[model samples]
Target chain A: MKIPKPTIKRLALYYRCLNRYREEGVNFVSSKDIAERLNLKPSQVRKDLSYFGEFGKRGLGYNVVKLVDELARIIGVNKVWNVAIIGAGNLGTALANYPGLLKHKFKVVALFDNDREKVGKKIAGIPVFHVGDLIRLTQELNIEICVIAVPELAAQRVAEIAEEAGVKGIVNFSPVKLRTSIPVEDVDITLSFETLAYNILKANPEMLKLIEEQ
Target chain B: MKIPKPTIKRLALYYRCLNRYREEGVNFVSSKDIAERLNLKPSQVRKDLSYFGEFGKRGLGYNVVKLVDELARIIGVNKVWNVAIIGAGNLGTALANYPGLLKHKFKVVALFDNDREKVGKKIAGIPVFHVGDLIRLTQELNIEICVIAVPELAAQRVAEIAEEAGVKGIVNFSPVKLRTSIPVEDVDITLSFETLAYNILKANPEMLKLIEEQ
Candidate 1:
């Protein structure tokens, strides 16, 4: 059975929440507690978990460690996946140094760039290679995922290179929309803020109208 | 008349798609065209749009410019929103320089950090201020939204400051899960990559099991 994309995303969130609970020495967590913490409804939590299988006992809450491990297994984050970043610029370098990626088992193995000066250099100890070597380096490093953090004009070309390199997935940070057969997850930071702005405006429709009239 | 969160997000995507279409001089777009470009179903596109009101003529499709303007207005992107970054780190500085935010009307008015050196510096011409003066500066600049890009340990504190400043919304880029009364939209870059990994692993379940056994 195919899982909804949103469900998959939520499973990752649930895993993160459970990890935090486990760290706090909380051994068990009720759906209600998880819901309240994540600002989700208890029914929504239960329904999302139901897709995987029965997890918790009727009376007792879920074992924090057990739930975290189960989610790790289900989300296939149990093993580290080699990741290659397509840009060696600010965003790409920042992502390369991101501690969360290593913690979550997404290892940055290589950085690719078209700039000759950046080539042979390292960002966060990850070697930077010319973009021309992307295909070769991807195979050499056994890279499974590619991150497109190049400029907007270069994003499409980099995405095509990653696709040609036979990458299994892509996490795009560029403003450009990439069209590729491999699954691409856009980390549009601006769009998230826009959504937040929309929510804020919705809550204050009068303010929104006032601004429009200005 | 509450719109689902997912639909609100999709509206942003639709607005973006319409922007691209308009740039290409495309005047009209059918739901199928929008759906196909966004990898969503035609019915889903129509359903998401129905939340606002009727759009597009039955036989003629939607006027691209009109649809773009409508979606922009609905998503509250028509006016500039004053934004402040709560960290002056690499990620925060990169975000400050990100052109996409300005394009979407989220103006980075200030950068807040505890570092004495960084506090007086400028990123992308936006002044960095001491986080201690967050509440005061927020009022002074009429800042509405705050972006949390601080480290994990500092995320919660930064969020509290933003909340105390009476910011309307927050876009958290840190790994930490912030607890606040104000609305927060997490742009967990790692979670996005993990979701991509999950989708890739799901497509190759045998490989996932093999990795699990290791």
Candidate 2:
């Protein structure tokens, strides 16, 4: 079954919500409650979940633990994924320290930088290596996922290197648009902020009208 | 006109791509080029741009500078926005140092933390304040945007504080789902990685089939 991209994204969100419910000792939750928590419509929630097998009872909603486990398995996050960060900059260093990634089974096994000084250092206990050694180290460490956190100018090159290293997937934090055979998810922070700005302006139609008038 | 949420997001991406073209001294670019760069269909690109106004000439394509300027104005990035970070943790600190936000007219003017030791400290030259002083400082600094980088447990409370502070928009980096009257864009890194994992597994159907067979 080919799931829509948006549905896959929402499945991850549903998994997170279900985990929270399980942690709170809530055994069962209605689609309405899950929808309300995620700020999504109940029908949308049901449709997204329907892509997989039917897990919810008609009136009982869903079993929190069961739903979470199913989603973890469906999303291929049930096992640990050894990952590598391609930049040792501030963003990369911060992501290395991010507890959420570790909690989600994605481990930053290595960091890569072109600077010789940073190459020997460790961010969050993950040793940084020279970019020249990315292919060798990724293979040695059994790293399947690569994160591109370098600057825009260096992003494409770094992505190419990761591809050459046989990475299966990439999470790109740089603003650059990278084209590779492997699945690449661009995590553009600026785009997220811009979307917020657009929505905020849209909410304030007067502001948008004022800008248009100008 | 009500633009679709996805269109608004692609507009930001289009703006970024246009900027790169302008930097490279490309005066005009066809929808095909833009679509190719963004990995979207040309018709989709045209449809997204059509929401605002006619941008491209029939055969001559779009003027890079004009398109970039129009998108910047349409997205409300033409004017500067004073922003605040509600956490002084590693993620917040890294966001404060992110050059992309500053490039997009969103300025991080204040950082807030509950820890007394970090209250007076500065991350990227932005002074930190006690979370208790958020409302007052946001007002004093004329901050309209807030970024929530606290842990999941504290995210909702921080978002509530930001809402009570009269923030116009929020970019939530915490995994916690927050509900507020203001527009909120949740930057869930875990969800992103999970989505990547799902796509990679989908690309390699054998892996998914093996998981299912287990």
Candidate 3:
């Protein structure tokens, strides 16, 4: 199914919050509730979900389980993915240990760091190896996707290697611009942080008073 | 200026990429190139930017500097933000040192962790302090935003405390849901990783078999 890029982004968010909504004993959720959580609009939320099908009723909201299932299927997270993280720094290790990454459909298979001393160490149970072993290990473990958390200077190079190693997808965290016609997605680490800050700043500029009073 | 939420998100990508476009001595970029990097339709890119004043000419494409300036103004990142991070664990410390967040508009002001060993220590010169000191220190430092990189259980509680302490915003990385009537924006950590993976998975399912062969 051809989903708009924006809709695809929202699918991930909907899936992420759906589990929590389930835990809270909330069986149905309106577009407004989801929008508030993500700071998005209810209309957009409804429209995005409506793109798939009518998961909601006339007066009620979407069924949590049903919506999650639909979204999961739509985003193609219905299957498992063995991920290879290409940086072993704090950010890389964080991603390796990030609970969100493993939730239900994702898995970290290996970690690659350039540092000799750090190689062979393990983070969140995933073994870390040298970046030199990326090609070898990816070939051996059948790692289809790579998460590039390396330094900015190394982003393009790591992406090149990952593509050459036959990586199907890449979730890059480097602040550098790396393009791979090989289905690589660069996570704009800094831009998101600023957006996060902007969300709060827009809501309460007076909050800056705390810093000033300090 | 009420812009569609999707437009705001895309604007972030445009601003980041256009900075590079300007640096590369490229003065004009079409909506098509923006669509390529951001993974959106060329028409969608043009339409989003249309809400703002026309930085794009009919035949000539967008002026790199002018577009960047408009985005900067529209996204409200034209000024610098002193950002404070709470919870200096793997995520916090990693975020503190993240090169992307340290760029043009955001600055890491303070780091807060409950761990005694981490307190008084500094990651990238941002001193890690006791979580207990957050309210006091944030007020003094004029921190414009708060980053909640704590564990899932601590996320909502900390956000509450941060709000009471004058924390205007939060960038949550926890797996759990955080309920806040106050101004808050939670980045579902798992959703990001999962969505990026899902998009890639669907984009190149055949590559999965390709990786096995390689």
Q: Pick the candidate with the highest TM-score.
A: 1
Spell out the clash pairs found in candidate 2. none
Q: Write the per-residue lDDT of candidate 2 for residues A69-124, one digit (tens) a residue.
A: 99999989887889998888877887998887888899999999999999888888
The runs of at least 3 residues in candidate 1 whose Cα sits more than 4 Å from the true structure, single-residue gaps closed, are A20-36, A41-67, A114-122, A129-133, B21-30, B56-66, B119-121, B132-136
Which of 1 and 3 is ahead in TM-score?
Answer: 1
- Candidate 3, residues B71-148: lDDT per residue as tens digits? 776566776777888888777888888766767678888998889999988899888889898889878998767888
lDDT of 2 by residue, B1-214 (tens): 6676667778888998899999999999999999998767888899999989999999999999999999998889888889999888878887988888898899999999999999998899999999999899888998989999887799999899999988999998886668899999977777779989988998898877776676
**Rank order (by DockQ, best first):** 1, 2, 3
Could you report the DockQ of all the candidates, in the order they appear? 0.64, 0.54, 0.41
Report the lDDT tens digits of candidate 1 across residue range B1-214: 8676778888889999999999999999999999998878899899999888888899999999989989988988888999999888878888988998898898999999999988788989999999999999989999999998888888998898898988999998886668998778888778797788888887777878688679
Q: Which stretches of candidate 2 lie over 4 Å from their true place?
A: A21-33, A53-66, A119-121, A202-206, A209-214, B1-74, B110-137, B150-161, B178-181, B209-214
Query: Model 1, A15-76: lDDT tens per residue?
Result: 98999899999988899999887767888889999899989887798989999999998888
- What are the lDDT scores of the predictions, listed in order? 0.88, 0.88, 0.77
Q: What docking tier does model 1 reach?
A: medium
Q: Which of the two, 1 or 2, has more TM-score?
A: 1
lDDT of 3 by residue, A1-214 (tens): 6878667777877887786798888998888889898778888888888887889987798899888877766676766778898888888877887776666667889999889888877888889889888888888998878888887888899899999888877776776667787765656656566566445545666644543454
